[model samples]
Target: MSQRPTQRCHDYVQEVFAQEDEILRTVRQQTAAHGMPQISLEPNEAKLLQLLVRLCSAERVIEVGALAGYSGICIARALPERGRLITIELSSLHADVARAHFKLAGLADKVTVRQGAGMEVLPTLAADGPYDLMFIDADKGNYANYLDWAAENLRLGGAVVADNAFWGGSIFNPQTDDDQAMVAFNRKLAAHPQFDSTIIEVGDGIALGVKTK
Candidate 1:
């Protein structure tokens, strides 16, 4: 029998394990004030991202989306002093906002905000790898493409983590193109021969795969 978390359980986890600091709170609030989409990861999910980074001992990280730098801060915090993070954002305004947040989080030295579409920026980043971790949270339609890139760029033990794996429960019966794309991405990640993958029932679901080849 599968046991899902209750609202109270979630609250407890947030209170204990995912409390937001002043810097993170400011990032979230300022992003909304700047009229950007308030779609960055929740505190719990941010904590999970940090945990995944530390679990994998990730030092070189690539973030496909840099929305106000909320998740970037979390990922950067988990990295060692010599760690580096390259985050991509399509909107210049959002990229600027994320850069400010990264500075505020005291992670400016650790992060590089690349202002471009994921597909366009990813190719330019190949020489920087093989990266230790790649986090996907950008356009849903291009998720599979990003995973394909990760497969080639990540080291044998590196990890690929994608958000919105459940697509708000739409993966069960995909109707829209985005839904279908997510389903296909999930299936491909699960069946990929070089990676061991699983979906963690976090906020919106997080699909995690570790390369073994």
Candidate 2:
């Protein structure tokens, strides 16, 4: 039998992410129109990004994936007046589309899309940054490396968000490669002393880790 969402969960999500401005709304429409997959962050994820931005009041932020520029726009919209977001996208073509969306959203000044493999791109990204926040939403096989690099780059008390952790609920299964990677990553994070994390089921799943020590 399929599980169903509780009424409280439904209501809570709606109440939390109800606020949407014209720019954000426009970007959402554009993502759909681009003929790309619905790879954008959902309303709940956007709300989480909004809350995290408010909490950090971040001047510098980094994101591992820039899929259609959806989450980047949401996060960029929340940054402080002078805040900036550095987003990495694997595909150059997607980078171009993302740039167009940022222009449409009027967030070009606050967000930059870097085109390259994150493993190669992340190291060269500002070494001075003990960034306030790091978001990893890239290829699943790279999660372990991404977490390692993010841990080194993030400031103490900073947060790292790893998306698609539950992998469409396949995380409990033992056979699939994606599930295995997620399971291993979950274990790595849970055992690491540097971070305290909670697995949250929003959209698919997100793992929020707070840097410690």
Candidate 3:
């Protein structure tokens, strides 16, 4: 595989989707079908989501945000036959759009969406124990809290992926009070004994954590 998706990879993604399974094709069309923000996963991000899900053979997954259902669709599509995905979305509007996309993707059954504050829902939902994978892409101020919860709730050998951790190349500067919260969370995630961490500068930013027992 190409180390990082550049022009060639972009072309490859188009090619991959040229013959994409009908579900993904429908998803792509639906995402393009609506005038949603470009919050959907980029090619590299989508590839990584797919890879992470396949690697874990994730039976259960949780997403902290469901912006248009772009990332959720990619992640959920990778699950096993018995797998399930629960996405927490803050907006009823986004949730409505995402529900339509999920239905179009033929994943309406496998994907469950809850609209509310993620923090309130997290404590209740995470108690079920050991979600195989979780993605954090919600408000930046809550990054640390989410990581703390994910550490406690995610299964051993599972993974937690955070997007926009870099905040559009802003982390390199002296951490500002505004973005410092996100930076602080990154340090906490790195130092935490339970996880093996890596930071990669993909779109915005992505941090991957492999949970250790």
Candidate 4:
């Protein structure tokens, strides 16, 4: 069997297809400098997000996590001139940092950084939907809940993309609530009658589902 993607493979893809620009680099640096967890999506993964956004012709996007705006920049860049993105972050500190980065990327006009728990803020956004796409990358335990919301709010033919689908390989033998939640999230998304879904083996893993019915 072919070997799974390794550090070298990631490095090669980063150099060729996912090189970070100055704005994105600064987001990463400032995220660490602010003592936040370095859990932002890999550059390659961000690139995939960009592709997915464009593929779905997404104009209104919802990001369940805004970690310093690294991924938000990528998602926003792929949007049309009038497109908009609303990203949610639990920490005020992280939200502030992301707002700064979004402004730095000259995307403040196109992005809104919401500071609150995902479930709390998500309901308030219903008036903005059904959104074209929704990206979930926040608390593991609430992934399925977020998916449920997406299923209800996403437009027909829209998409729901979740990060950490593999949960660091723990899905196979879930030992914690978070791991079990991810396992259930993956299963539910894949089996949902209204959606067609699959796991794309990128950084950690990416679960992508499209609303079909």
- Model 1 spans with C-alpha error above 4 angstroms: none
Name the top TM-score candidate: 1
The C-alpha lDDT values of all candidates are 0.95, 0.83, 0.82, 0.95
| Alpha-carbon RMSD to native, per candidate | 0.9, 2.8, 3.2, 1.2
**For model 2, what is the C-alpha lDDT against the true structure?**
0.83
C-alpha root-mean-square deviation, candidate 3? 3.2
Deviation (Å) of 79 in candidate 3: 0.5
Task: Give the per-residue lDDT of model 2 (tens digit) for 87-117.
Answer: 9999887788889888888899999999999
Give the lDDT of residue 177 in candidate 4: 95
How does candidate 1 score on lDDT?
A: 0.95
Of 2 and 4, which scores higher on TM-score? 4
Query: Ten residues in a row with the worst lDDT in model 4?
Result: 2-11
Q: Candidate 2 — which residues are off by over 4 angstroms?
A: 1-8
- TM-score ranking, best first: 1, 4, 2, 3
Evaluation by TM-score, superior candidate among 1 and 3? 1
- What TM value does model 2 have? 0.90
Candidate numbers sorted by lDDT from highest down: 1, 4, 2, 3
1 or 2, which is superior by lDDT? 1
